[model samples]
Structure formats: structure tokens, C-alpha cells
Target: MRRILAIGGGGFTTEKEPSLVDAYIHRLIDKPRPRICFVATPSGDNRAQIDKFYEAYGSLDCEVSNLPFFNGWGPNVIPYTDFKPHLLSQDAIFVGGGHLRSALAVWREWGLDVAMKEAWNRGVLLAGMSAGAMCWFETALGGPFEQGNYGVQRGLGLLPGACAAHYHNAHVSERRVNLLAEMHRGLIPSTLAIDDFAAVLFEDQQLVKTVSWASTSTAYRVRQQNGCVEEAPLTAVPLQESLIV
Candidate 1:
């Protein structure tokens, strides 16, 4: 089945120590030594972020590699001509977070978008945090645009509706408010709002469950109702206890 784990926040890049969430992602692959590839396009293939991935996964039982889109960093990047086959061979592809709009543009230009779609269809576990999470849905909240305005942004539409990441983060608390407003205004359809350290899992385009590594982390389903915004929490299971693969 096609699967996706869309994380709102918190991952190897955000934490110094490895998290249960990362381990949970590894378990989902069902391979004794899963071949997991990091897609760091959103972070412009930031070397620091890539290093964090290695730090977290290198000692694990799985095999780890990364596909870099940006050039000049010079880190054993797979050639552009080999991207399709290389991505398809992996058991999972984890995208890193960064500038969403710019990432999608570069992805489209490189035709990485098409390769990802194929990977998803082939049942490769597609997962990521923040921008990586939002890219799989139909629409996502794009923000701080021109005078700090937030609005709807297009996605690859692998799944329906919209997505909002960091919904409860104090640093970007406005995300929750703006997301509700957009849904209330009918500017975007029902959306999934995910907090830091929380993630919503999708199987074959249907949300199967929510899970989190942090106690306060959670997910929400928000939509317009009776001319007002309404939201309901999506119950999350603790990833430390169960392997929901």
C-alpha cells in the first residue's frame, strides 16, 4: 500500500539526539536493513542537515543515503540522470524541511516530483517534516508572504485537502489562526494541522492514524462550519510503545 508519514515538526534535523519518531519511521519499512534515502531539496541540500541525518541513522540497522539537488556542496550526489532509478530503489524517502515554495520549484525543474510520485505509488514509505509533510497534499499554508500574510499554496496533490505544519508552535503560532481563517473563508478545503513532534499517517491516501513522540504534540482536523471555523483534535498514539507498521 502507498504510505506517508507527514510530520508537523521535530525530527533528526531539529533534535541533537535521535528521537523515537525516527525509529518508528525505520520500523515502517519492514526491511531488516531498509534502504532509506534523504531528500534534502527543501533545505537546499544543506550539509549540516544532511550530516544530522547521518548522525541519527548511520548507527542504526538500516542503510542510509541522501539525494542532493543543489550543486557545489560536493557530497557524493547521485547524478541527475540517475535520480529516478536511485529514488525508486529505496524503501523509504525522507524529505527535510525548509523553504516550501522554492523547494517545489526546484523539484519540478529537476523532475524529482515525478519520481517521488512513482515512488509513492510503488509503496515506498514517503515521509518528511514541515515542508516535506505539506508537499504531499493538495494544498498547504504558505506564509509570511509580503507583510507577513499567509495564504494557500499548491502541493503535489498525492493526497486530498490541505495541510498546515507547526500549527501549535509558539514561534509560528499565527499558523493555527491563519489556517482556520483560510478554511473559514472557503479559500482552502478541510485541512490537517500537525504540531511539532506529531504526525498523521496515511495509507493509500486515507489517514490511518496519528502518532507522536512528545506528550504535548498532536494533530487536528480543521474546517468551516456554520460560517465559522471548527477544529477537532486527532487522537495520537505514543510512538514509544507501538510500532504501527
Candidate 2:
């Protein structure tokens, strides 16, 4: 079954304790030393994102490669092979988070979206944090921070309904609330809000698991009840809760 392990936030580039979430993602591939690829196209293939990816994945018992789409990509993605083949070669690919609108625009232009869907069908786990996570859902909330308003953005619809990242963040909690309110107003049917360090996992098309890098993290299922927003805490199992395999 195709799977998506969408992380809300928290990782090498975002926080100090990034290892837990990254390590958990590797285990989900369930292979003895899998080949993991980093897709940094979202962040304009930023060097720092790639650097931190290696910094975290380097010590793990797996082979790591990167797909850089900006500024003359490195040998891993360009001058080495074609697009679809590169995506299919790995056991998993982790997308770096950045501007969602810009990322999707670039991906579609290069047909990486089509390639990723193919890779997902081939059982390569599609995973990411923030914008990376939100894009997989049918709809997502995107905000103009300066204006303090958010609106729904269409996603690839690999998963249904709307999705929210950084649910409990200090600076961004208002955005999350805005999305929930929109859901209540019937602008969106339902929404899934994931706190930093938490992830909601989908196996095939069914949501089967919620895991967190930190115990404090929580996942929420949000919807409209009567004329108001309704929210319930999802049971998110911490990554340290048990042995993955």
C-alpha cells in the first residue's frame, strides 16, 4: 500500500532535537539500511536544508542521496540520471519544507509531481514537514502573515480533506485557528491539525497512526459541530514509545 508519513514540524533544520523524527521515518521503510533521498526542491534546493539532512541521516545505517532542483543541482539529481528513475531508486524520499505555493509551481513545471505519484505507487514512502506535509492533502490553509489571514489552497489530494501544520506553534497558532474556523463555516469540510514534532501516518488511503518526536506533541481532528468549530485530540504515540521493528 502507498503510504504518506506527514510530519507537522520539528527536524534538523527547524529544531535542536531533530534526530528522533528523522530516525522514525527511516524505520517505517522497514528495510535493513534503506536508501533515502532528500528532495529540497521546495526550499529552492537550499544548501542548508540539504546539509542538515545529511547531518542527521549521515550516522544512520542507510544510504543517502539528494535531489536538488535549484542552482545547478548536484550529481545526485542532475548529470547522473533522469527524473522518474531517480525517484524510484530510493526506499524513501523526504521533501524539505518551504513556500508551498512556490514549491508546487516548480514541481508541476518539471513534472516532479507526476514522478512523485508514480514513486508513491511503487511503495516509496512520501514524507515531509510543514509545506511538504500539507501539500499531500486535498486542501490546506496558506496565509499571508503580514495580512493575518489564511485561505484554502488545493493539494495533490493524495489524502482527503484539509491539513494544517504547526498547529500549536507560538507564532502560528492563530493561523491554525483560522483554518478551523473556515472549516466550521463550511469553506472546508474537515481539517487535520498536527503540532510540531507530531505526524499523522496514512497507509494506503486510511489513517492508521499518529506518532510524535516529542511526547508533548499532539494531533487534532477538527470539524464543524453545530455552527462552531469542534476539535478532539488524536492519540499520538511518541516515537520512543516502542521499538519500530
Candidate 3:
């Protein structure tokens, strides 16, 4: 009963195609009005980005609330058991982009990930962009910064294997791909690289469809081990076609 929309990078507010966002919202909440919890790690420079997200969905009948983990003006808010009930009550949860490692670390320490999974199992809509999207996979590509090539940090594991975000964006360069390819060698799984403005939808624990801004995006199924690499374009394959069982 879990419905997840993992956007590559661009968010509903930034994209010209607002229909994609609208459609996902409606699907997540059957009613005309739904309560949405906006989870963000508000770094100093992300105020504009966070505000843009609110502006996009503010008009809807939904009640939107911002739950920021990193309070720039104050100390970090550790995740606590007291927040569990409030988290479960949300109809939809939208996560914002930021330092993926920091975000995951805080989420795990506070047990927000566990609480989110419980909410999803009880039928909640989970959506996000960039770093938010990366959390859905088992492993995520760290950053383009000096944090060193890639970090195989564990994710929510909602979907198995690893995912590379900002596929065609300048942040994820060819060098980053090469590093990921080398790191994934001998792993008993495949990796998916999703380009900006693209998204892959999952329902009932399977990939339902891949959507993007009309050829502006690409999806790749990459397999590698011991320096050998093989990759192919991911077609609009049905969820049933790639069952891992």
C-alpha cells in the first residue's frame, strides 16, 4: 500500500509541467484535501529552495507543515519517539534536497526512517526530489563535492540496489559514474542512473512507470563487476517485467 514518487532532481515547483506533481498528489490522497508534512534540513542557503516548494503546493486544500531537522538559528533537532505519532498522521510526506549523508544520519539517529516506513505500510504517499529521491534506494551517490567520489551509505532500502541522482546534471559528471561503476563491482545487484526532470514511480513495491520532460531525461540499467561494465537504456518496462524474485 506504499506509493512513492522518486524524482531525479527537478521538483514539482521548478518544472513547467505541474501536472506531474498534481497527479502524484491526487494519487497519494484520494480526497480533495490531504495533510502534507514537508521534511527538510534547512541549510542557510536553502531558504529559497524550500520556499519554492511551499509556493507550488500552497494553493491546494492540503494543510502543509514544515518540519526542518537542521535549524540554522538553533541546535540540530534530534529525531525522537515523541514525533512518531505526528509522523504517522501525515497523508503525504515531501522531502527536500540537501546534503544526503547529513540528512540520512539525522533521520536514522532520530528513527524517522523507521517511522516513515511504518506510515508508508499504513498507506501514505511518499514523495521528494534529489536527495529526497535518493533516500528511497538502498544506496545513493554522495555528492559532487570534495566528500570524495561516492559514499555507499545505506538508504531506506524501500527499493533494492543503488541509485544515482542528477544523472545528466553537471553535478554528476562522467568521473562520478566511473567511480560508481568501480565501487559497484562484484555487487549482486544493478544500479539506476536517473537524469534531471525525470522520475520513476513505484507502487506495491515495483516500478510502475518512468516519466520525464519529453526526452529531457534518461534512465540507465548498469551492471558491473571487476572492471567489466555493461549498461543499457531503461525502457518504459512494466513493474512485472523486472521482478527480482
Candidate 4:
């Protein structure tokens, strides 16, 4: 089945980070020691984020490598990263978060967008947090990057409808409002939202599971009826604290 896991950001990328939810993401891969590739094309291949990805995954048994899209490192400003061969070889692709607009542009230009859909068809798990997670959906909340606020925009469409990450963060109230308002206004279809420390897993375009690191986090299915946008909570299975380490 084609699988996509949308994360709410902050899970297993640093020594001090929590891995409970991340562990769930890793286990989805059906390999003894999965070949996991990190794609930080979204974050402009930021060095620190790339370093953290290696550092965190390095502790695990999986073989890890990163696909960096650096200027001059490729044929043009978009980079010449050969998107398929390396992607087809991996068991999973973990993308990093950054400016979604620019990230999508670069990926489409490099053919990484098409390659990613191909990888998904071949049973490779496509997953990421925030902007990374947002990339796989047809529409997502959090963009335009103006005035330090959020808005909705088109996504890669690997998954249907819309999604918003960090749903419960107090700082993102405007984001939540914008998403619900957009839905209520009939600007987008039904949407999904996940708080930090949680993830909504989709298999074959169907939501198969919702899991959270701690009992406190959750996911939601939001839809518009008439002129109102409402939320129906999706209970997340709580992970044992032991799995966090």
C-alpha cells in the first residue's frame, strides 16, 4: 500500500529530541535495516538541519544518506540532483521542513516531485514534518510567509484534501483560524490537523492510524457544513514512554 505519514514537527532529529513518534514512523518501513534517505531540499539544504538528520538517524541501525540541493552543486539554480536512481534505492524518504513555496518549486524543477510519487508507488514510505508533511497533500495550511502569518497553498497531491501541522501550538492560532475559515468558505476540501508529538498515517489514501508520543496529543478531521467548519477528534494511540528513548 502507498503510505504517507504527516508529522506535527519535533521528533527525533537531535540528541535532546523525543523519538516516540519518530519510532512509529521508522517501524512502518518493512526492512530489517531500512535504507533511509534524507531530503532537505525544502530547507534550502540547510547545513544544521542536514547535520541533525544524520546525527539522529546515525544512532539507529538504518543506512542513512542525504540528498542536498546546493547552488552550483547542480546544473542550475534549481540544482542538478538526479532525483530517481538514489530515491528508487531507498526504503524511505524523510524530508526536512522549510519555506514550502520555494521548496516545491525546486522539487518540481528537479523532477523530485515526480520521483517521489514514483517512490510512493514502489512501497517506499514518504514522510516528513511541517512543510515536509505539507508537501504530500493536494492542499495545506501554512504559506505565503508574509507578515509572519500562515495561509493555504497547493501541495504535491500525493495525498488528498488538506492538512495543517502544529495544530495545537498556541503560537499558531492564526494558522488554525485561517485553515478553518478557508474550509468554511469552501476554498478547500475537508482537512486534517495534528498537534505536535502526533502523526496521522495514511495507507492507500485511507487514514489507517493516528498515533501520538504522549497521551496529551491528538489529531482531527475538519470539515465544512453550510457555513461552519467543525472538528471531529481522532483519538491517537498513546506510545509507551519506554519507546521514547
Candidate 5:
């Protein structure tokens, strides 16, 4: 009964979608008012980035608990048994953007990933944007480059295969697309390239739909195997009916 909302990172609050934040809040509380935990990790300590998230969700009247990562590490490694309980007590969990590799490493070190999967199994809401959304996949493109580290790094594996974030934006530079193509050339399955302001929602481990605030975003499905590469626009197919259940 887990509900997950993954956004590609844009149009968080717009005139036409005022309920974007409220929708998340309602998913957490299922009522007018509810208490929830806000797990945020901003890669850089920019006040603007921090305030933007606060303002977006704060307007919805949801109780937010800021849990910022320590030096890029999360609160999972504190050796406190109370960590799981504290997370479970909340109606939903919201993960903010940051370095995907660092976030997943910290989460795995402290069993945060395990806890989250357990919570999801128990019907807790799991939501994220950008890096947060990328971490859930089995593989992530450009993560090793972002961390300045070489070699393939494993992801949380919540979803099988690789995911490419900021698909259109990153493609502008070509480096990101090259990295993703390189990764796809390896053993990874077809990669999911998510454009900004778009998201693919999942429920019960099944993809439900793709949503966009401005309809400017797009997704690409790329597959390379045995020296043959194939790329196609993801929107041409229906996701809900095609997702493996």
C-alpha cells in the first residue's frame, strides 16, 4: 500500500498547480491537517535552496521536521535505535535533493534504505525530487562523475535499472548523455531519462503514470546491448499497462 511520488525537479509551485504541495501533504495526512517528517539534504549550503523547499511545503500547513545531512552524510549512522521509530512515527517521508551517491551510501550504512522499504511496505508515503528520485533506481547516470569518483556505484535498487535525471537539461551539455550511454552500454537495462518538471509515479511497485506541470519535459528510453544501441521517446508507449507487476 505504499504511495510514492517522484518529481524530476521543477514547477514545484505554480499557479495552475497550487495543490502540488498540498497533494503531498494530503497523501501524508489524508486529511486537512497532519504531521510528517521532512528529510532534506541540500548538496550545497545555499540559503536559497533551503528556503525554496521550506516555502513550497510550509504553505501547505504540514508539520515539517528538518533533518539535514551532516557533511553530506545523513542521520542513519548515529547508532541510535530510535532512528527507525522516529521515521515510522511519521505519516510520510520526503527526501530532498543532493549528491545521490553520498545520500545512498549514508542510507545503506545506517540501514535507512531498509527502514524506508519496511515503512513503505507498511503503507508509509515515500516521496522525493531530483537526486532523491534518482537514488531509488538500481543504477544512476553521471553519479560517479558528480562525485568525482570513477567506476560504477550501486544505487538503493528500489527500482531496477538505471535512471537519468535532468534528461533534457543534461543533454544540452552532451557529457551527461555520454555518461548515460556509457552506463547503458554496460550490463544495465534500458535507462530512464527524466526531464525537468516531469515525474513518473509508482504505487505498489508499479508505474502508474507520468506527470508534468508545464508539459515541457520529456523522457527517453535508451537501450544498448551487444554493440547495438536503440533509443526512443518514452511517451510513445503507455507506462501503466507496460510496467512489470
Candidate 6:
């Protein structure tokens, strides 16, 4: 099945070893020493983030690599000529967080969006946190609007509905409010809001479950019913329990 694991937050970026969310991601890949590639385009291919990715996955059982767009092609960077083939060869692809509008524009300009779609169709696992999580849905909240206004941002449409990442995270209180208001005003369709340390799993474009390393973190289904916006929490299975045997 084509699978996408959209994480609202928490992973190597915030946690250390014994990270339940990262472990769950690794388990989803069925290969022995799975080929996992990290795409940090959203972060403008930030070197620090790239370093963090390597540091985190370097000791793991899988073979690790990354796709860098900002840095010119080199011995380490995958050349544009092999981009599609290289992506398709991987068992899983992880995208990093950054400016959604800028990231999406770059993806389209480089045709990486198409390549990603092809990769998903070929059964490669597509996953990421925050901006990465928001990239797969038809619509997402959080945009490059004026004065940090939260607006409806279109995504790759790999999954249905809208999404709000870091939902209820105290740092992004504005996002929480805007998403609900947008739905209440019928400005956007029903949305899936994911809190830090939690994630929503989709297989064949259908939400299979929500999982979290943080036991208290969960996903929410937000929608407008008769002018009232409602937030319904989806019980999150502990990541450890959701892992495949």
C-alpha cells in the first residue's frame, strides 16, 4: 500500500534515542537495512538540519542518504539527472520543515513534486514532520501571508482534506485560532489538526490511525457544523503499541 506518515512534531529534531515516533517510522519500511533518503528542501536544505538528520539516522540499521536542493550537485548531493531514479530506489523519503509556500514553489519549479507523486505511486513511504506533514494534504493551514496570518495553503493532494500541524502548540497559538475560524467561515473544508509528538497515518490515501510517542498528544478532526466549529480528538495509539511485529 502507498503510505504516508505525517508527523505534527517531535522526532530527531527534538528527541533523543528511544524515540518512539522515529522507531515507528523505521518499522514501517519492510526492507532489511532499508534505503532512507532525507529531503530538506523545506528548510532551504539547511546544513544544520542535514547534519542532525545524519547524526540521528547514522547509527540506525538502515542505509541513509539525503537529497539537497540549495547546495549545488556534488559527490554527496544527488545530481538532477538521477533525481527521479534515486528517489524511486529508496524505501522511504523524509521531508524537513520550513516555509511552506517557498518549499512548494521550489518543488514545482524543479519538478520534484511530480517525482514525489511517482515515488508514492511506486509504494515508497513518504513522511515528514510539521511542514513536511502539511505538504501531503489537499489543503493545509499555515501560509506565507502578511504579518504571519494563517491562511489556507494548498498541498500536493496526496491525501484528502486540510491539515494543521503543531495544533494547540503554545508557540503557534495564532495557527490554532485561524484554522478554526477558517472552517467556521466555510473558507476551508474539514481539517485534521495534529499536535506535537503525534501523527496521522494514511494508507492508500485513507487515514488508518493516529499514533504518538507522547501519550497525551493526539490528532483532531475539525469541521464546521451549522456555523459552529468543532474539534474532535482522534485517540492516538501509543507508537510503541502500533509498531508491526
Alpha carbon lDDT at 145, candidate 3: 34
What stretches of model 2 exceed 4 Å from their correct place? 73-75, 79-81, 145-149
Predicted candidate 5 versus true structure: per-residue lDDT over 57-154, tens digit per residue? 56676655545445323222222345687777667777767677766777777688898888777877777777767777777653444323322457
Order of models, best TM-score first: 1, 6, 2, 4, 3, 5
Residue 44 of model 5, lDDT score: 40
Q: Output the number of the lDDT-best candidate.
A: 1
C-alpha lDDT of all candidate models, in order: 0.85, 0.79, 0.67, 0.76, 0.60, 0.83
**Per-residue CA lDDT of candidate 2, range 90-191, in tens?**
899888888888878777887888888888989999999988898888886655532334656777788888888888888766767667656666776678
Task: List model 6 lDDT by residue over 121-221, tens digit each.
Answer: 99999999889999999986766433335667789999988888898788767677777766676777888999999999999999999998776899999
By summed lDDT, the worst window of 10 consecutive residues in model 6 runs over: 142-151
Cα-based lDDT at residue 214, candidate 2 = 72
Candidate 4, residue 40: lDDT:
80
In model 1, what is the error at residue 172, expressed in angstroms? 1.5
Clashes of each: 0, 0, 0, 1, 0, 0
Tens-digit lDDT string for candidate 4 (37-154): 8888777878777767666666667777777777323211222446588788888889877788888888888788899999999989999988888889998776653333446678
Q: Model 1 off-target regions past 4 Å?
A: 72-76, 145-148
Model 2 gets an lDDT of 0.79
Worst 10 residues of 2 by lDDT: 72-81
Model 1 residue 60 CA deviation in Å:
1.6
In angstroms, give how far residue 69 of model 3 lies from its true place.
Answer: 1.9
- In the order shown, the candidates' Cα RMSDs to the true structure are 2.0, 2.1, 5.7, 3.8, 5.9, 2.1
**What's the ranking of the predictions by lDDT, best on top?**
1, 6, 2, 4, 3, 5
Candidate 3 lDDT over residue span 1-245, tens digit each:
78887877776545654544445554557776677777775232265655665666665666666666554221222244476777688888888777788888788887888988998898888887778887888887656433344555688888877887777777547634555555465532467777776778789778877766545575677777566766666664332222323
